[model samples]
Target: MEASSNFLKRSGFLTLLMIFVLCCSKEVNIPEPVQAYEPHTSKIREILFIGNSFTSFNLGISYHLNLYLANDSLSYKPLIQEAAFSGYSLAVHLTNEQTLAKLNERSWDVIILQENTDIAVNDTMATLESIKAFQELVGNKGTLIYLLMSWPYKDQPEMLIPIIKTFEEGSQAIGATIIPVGEVWTAINQDGNPNIDLYNADGMHPSLQGTFLAASMCYSHIYNQNPSENPYLAGLENTTALYLKQKAN
Candidate 1:
């Protein structure tokens, strides 16, 4: 009877070990998880511009960007949506229901924001508040936001100091990136570049050359590509285009 009991216990233990080994040895086919598409790629598909004439002037930001990209022989062509109104402040956009609605209208890869040129200097708090609100509204939607730091008035170059400060504060507060267009203009001016005039007759809006520079900056930021390689001239002389593109890069 003792021998039979020992035999039974040994048999049971062997069976259990065999079962565990069998279970562990078999390959379990867990499907590899599908990767989500990233929006920030070498090929940016959609962009939403939210601002005033600073973004839409001189045949529009969209036009110049597309022209540059297409001329560069890129595989992807971007679809740009502009929600810009001339002379509108960030406060106006905050109160405008249409602007809020437009945020949900599409899946934008990038949303570029340009405030009224003077608002950042004159009313920094209001500008910062609106930027914060917009950033919150657009942040979670999987879109990158960029602040276009426009140039100060031509006559009042001193205004740039405060304006740059305001944009810096606003961008830090909201975690948005800034495209330093104003800084670029300042550099060109301080360097004594005789060929580049970035402003229109109003001294606020950009000239065709200014728009080209702005567009190149936008393109570079969005696509992660160098702007100098682009072939689109935007009617600018080759030397001027090359200079602007180099600065934009």
Candidate 2:
């Protein structure tokens, strides 16, 4: 009888021990969501920017883009043009004569497309239709098109979801690459490292810091180089620039 009792207790202890080991193993091997990336060595030169105030605001993305490339030691530089309109949506740009005229006027190596912030979030169909229209307009051209995903409003953080989705859908539909600037902004805010203000007082336009971050990511994506390696600060402190560069990746 004593032997039987001892055997039962030993079995119970072994079972508990096995459960503990299994739990620990699972904890140690927790799985995380996989991220898909496309790393390329393509060099972009002779670019054009088209969109609303996001592309045309405060020296605009093109201005800092040149600064970033010019500062890089790798010797890649491009003539950048800004053909952005204030408060314009992709839908509006689709019909705008100036945008079309610019496309027809020059042989561009790449065209950076940015949609209005609210339109991208609230009206995805418009975004998609506009992208389709642009693709059709630029048909058969060797110029590469890149979607510059705009960020959400400062107060409306959830606005990011649809904006990102629209950009992703548009890029996939047109077979273009996305600069993912909006996604990077979301990440920067979530990571909270240095916690820099990416917006101007209006909470819509990008401040200098915001433009620097966007420019850094654009430079990194277009040149296929690590943003952290670039020495341009856009007059920002080294620490701030380093943090933005790391977040761009």
Question: Quick one: best lDDT, which candidate?
Answer: 1
Model 1: worst 10 consecutive residues (lDDT sum): 35-44
Off by over 4 Å in 1: 1-43
Instruction: Compute the lDDT for candidate 2.
Output: 0.83
Tens-digit lDDT track of model 1 for 102-200: 878887888888989878888999898988887777777788888999898888899899889999998898788899999988888787788888889
Task: Go through the candidates in order and give each one's C-alpha lDDT.
Answer: 0.84, 0.83
Candidate 2 residue spans exceeding 4 A from truth: 1-43, 73-77
**lDDT at 163, model 2:** 86
Task: Quote the positional error of residue 92 for candidate 1 in Å.
Answer: 0.5
Tell me, what's the RMSD of every candidate? 15.1, 13.5
For candidate 2, what is the TM-score? 0.79
